[model samples]
Target: MANHVYTAAALAAAFFLAPANAQASPQAALPSAEVTTAVDDVVARYELPGIAVGVVVDGKVRHWEVRGETAAGSGERVGRDTLFKVASNTKAMTAALLARQVDAGLLAWDDPVVKHLPGFRMYEDWVTREMQVRDLLIHNSGMGPGAGDLMLWPEPNHFTRDDVIAGLEYLKPRWSFRSRYAYDNTLYIVAGEVAAAVGGAPYDVLLRREVFEPLGMDGCRIGEWRISEAGSVASPHVKRQGQWIARQDGEVVADMPMAAAGGVRCSLDSMLRWTQTWLAEEGDTPHSGWLSKKQREAVWTPHMPMPLTSRMREWNKSHFYAYGYGWRLSDVDGTAKVAHTGTLSGMYSAVTLLPELGTGFVILINGEAGEARTVLEQVLTKHFTAPGQNRTVAYYAEDLARERAAPESSAARQSSGAPVADARASAPRSIASSSELAPWLGEYRDPWFGDVSICPSDSGARFESANSPRLSGPVFNAAGRFLVDFEALESDADAWLDFANDSPDGKKQLTMAKVDPDADFSYDYEDLHFRRTGECASQ
Candidate 1:
């Protein structure tokens, strides 16, 4: 796993000097202090629990540093090699693995997924047959963003790769198949299985051999088991009571089933090597051969166009935004920018590449704040180009303000046996008691997410979901609906379970909605359709 290491002096020698035939700008080649100051300032202002920053300039690690602690409570300072969950950044690696299979002639990018894995399917038969391997990498599967994330988040599930594939058949599409771009993680799980079927090895095993070993990523590992064993990993934290607090060990484990989509963990050392490999002038490299020029180009080429309504474009001064294989492709200051971000419960990271300038940066944060992108913007400004005077800084400061104002951030205040201020202030005057909820006791089921049982307990009733025991909690009647509190989760929001006899048979159906508007959009409970089907409800 060992590869060449370029020291600062060696990097200066390799990149600052031009060939005898060509000229290079010495002024532009020297390292600048602007990038370091910007990164440090962002971390301090955001109160990020821990952060690791790595910059690859001209195929070498010109800047690498770790600042802050492994956890909020622990005073242990993070080392350069400390492992942090890269989350959805793993998608690019998955795409890279697929590229390798293509290079080996084991699979084609446009081949229908069914050709590689039998029994693979979606809500519609046509979609199942026409869904190509490339479709899996892009976000145009017609399923809404984070459509089925509840099945695997917060609490790890007993589901396997087969279970994930089976659940897809029941997931109804929010948009016509392939009509629009909606990010969905479930398809990536299917893509990982396709790699297994075509590569003749398990998904994790295939990646370790084909991607990690070849790239000299000695500290990198995929999935929960591998990550849990990786020593000296930075502990995840969440902002609570206006301070960062370490997440309990019981809830900090990675979602193993969703590994393909967002479960790779590594350090800055490995990430810098990865950045250099992708920024290779020519795609061919003796150290890594899985991604060819064409393959690399294919992933960076826009596969689905983005709506650009988001603030990301404004901050980066991008003309348009679109999704490539596993990367987000756009033009910042008329220069091609390729990047992707990753997020778990309390971990956030950003990996960006500037192919035109032969520069790239990887930022890993052990907290939930998405300031990585903000920090990267500053780094780009100092190294390649600047956005504008005071423009990016003002935008980033506003973002930090929003994160602090969010209701979930006052979690510690709510956890102290007090009603959430926003919830209490806006709640309706009339409170429905347990007696009013008598008609709602039943077992309900969703085709994709399985079942939930609302059974009578001493106080009110206990609520339990099939694959999500961590979401089990006490249910109370409030605002004419049943409010279930998931004590196991970090947030203080209550899940509102609304019931109605809208079914043709008048059998009563239940659908869930998050009462807190500030709740993370990934908790897409509103997508579920739960129908009553048990003797308890009949009585």
Candidate 2:
């Protein structure tokens, strides 16, 4: 095990920042043996390709661990500076960049977004006029969760920032503006644009200058970079056929339109520094001069109420939950906690901060290890929240096991008194005949998503998106319901085609819903309102 510890003096000197006053005596050296054992158990159990864990206490990095290969069988070992896409954790940083603008009198949080981007518009004219800059960070825009995300992901899509702004005007709201919380990423992309317009630089340039540079976070990169030039980067992986498969090993870099929302990449060492900045005493860190106390407080202030999940209630005894600017605010045990988790196709990251305890930890992985991230997060959080309780990874793993088994316990009372099968089992297994699919074959168009066509294929029919090529897949009949099973393994979402009975305008209207309830919200198929405009064009 390679243990890397940064002293207060070293951090201060490296960043040219003042040391925060010690809040409490530094905790005893982290139990390296216990931590190692716990991490080993999780890696073995989940088959994680690579993971990096960093713990900070009293404004100093107390523990750092990097384990396994960057990609399964890649021969590249995980290192302190191995870059992993931090994903949505980039939101908090973007929020901070906005706060910096507020400090400089460039823009106010409550300023109408149209004041900066005159072209900005929402589906509702009133919302377009009323949306504030602050509204961009909180998830209360009335747009449903992950609304309009198809444009930003299955990455390397052709969508640009201007395209995202234009698409918002067509994203109909599910509720009244600010009526409830439903997380969406499109607004954050807009916020990044706002920052760029006001700061006289691109989003990535502004972030690097305002946030990364001042804090000495040299390992973080937002925009384009050659893979060969990017040192020691972790490769993303997904499980297929019970084996981990690398997603991309070639040298192709795609523009990240989602850079402001979920596109920053950073290493464990840099992430620990970022976490320390938040946990540090006010006005003590070097970048304190760049961001004002008022703005900092505003970033952490609750802006929207969030639903409290059963897991949070059971694990943290959380009484209330809410969304702050970029972080989720809640209480664990009785201590105030602020945190966020970032997820991409096969990457996962969790940052947990116990403000009252002056301690925090980060977990970064390069595989689809959501369960492992959860248990490991609980393990580290418990180290501070319930130190004497001695909850280890195994303990939390067992707890997760019990939770998974609970559904089975209630299966006896279900209709069949049997275990629930895969979600697709309820659909018809027989393939639909070509004639049955003939009526559905046509070229359809969505205002925001451009065009998708259902055309004849060897397998009866196929679904193809013009802008999002990864979404092309075969249309199958499960029972009688026609569904599209996307061929791109990374684009895991599959949707069912539901055609509306009445075509008031003489154009057959079709809508979709995810076949899997747990599909990532980014697969916002439900948001697509496709109208059959004409017959499919020749291939």
Best by TM-score: 2
Error of 2 at 206 (Å): 0.6
Q: What's each prediction's TM-score?
A: 0.85, 0.91
lDDT of 2: 0.82
List, residue by residue over 346-437, the lDDT tens digit for candidate 2. Answer: 89999988766678888999999889999998877766776677787777888888887775433553553332334563656554555787
What clash pairs does model 2 have? 428-478, 428-479
**Model 2, TM vs. native:** 0.91
Task: Write model 1 residue lDDT over 285-402, tens digit each, in one string.
Answer: 5664556767766777677766664455655565566777788876666455778888887998888876666778888899977665565554454356442343344456777578
Q: Evaluated with lDDT, which candidate comes out highest? A: 2
lDDT to native, each model: 0.74, 0.82
- Listed per candidate, the RMSD to the true structure in angstroms reads 8.8, 7.5
C-alpha lDDT of residue 198 in model 1: 90
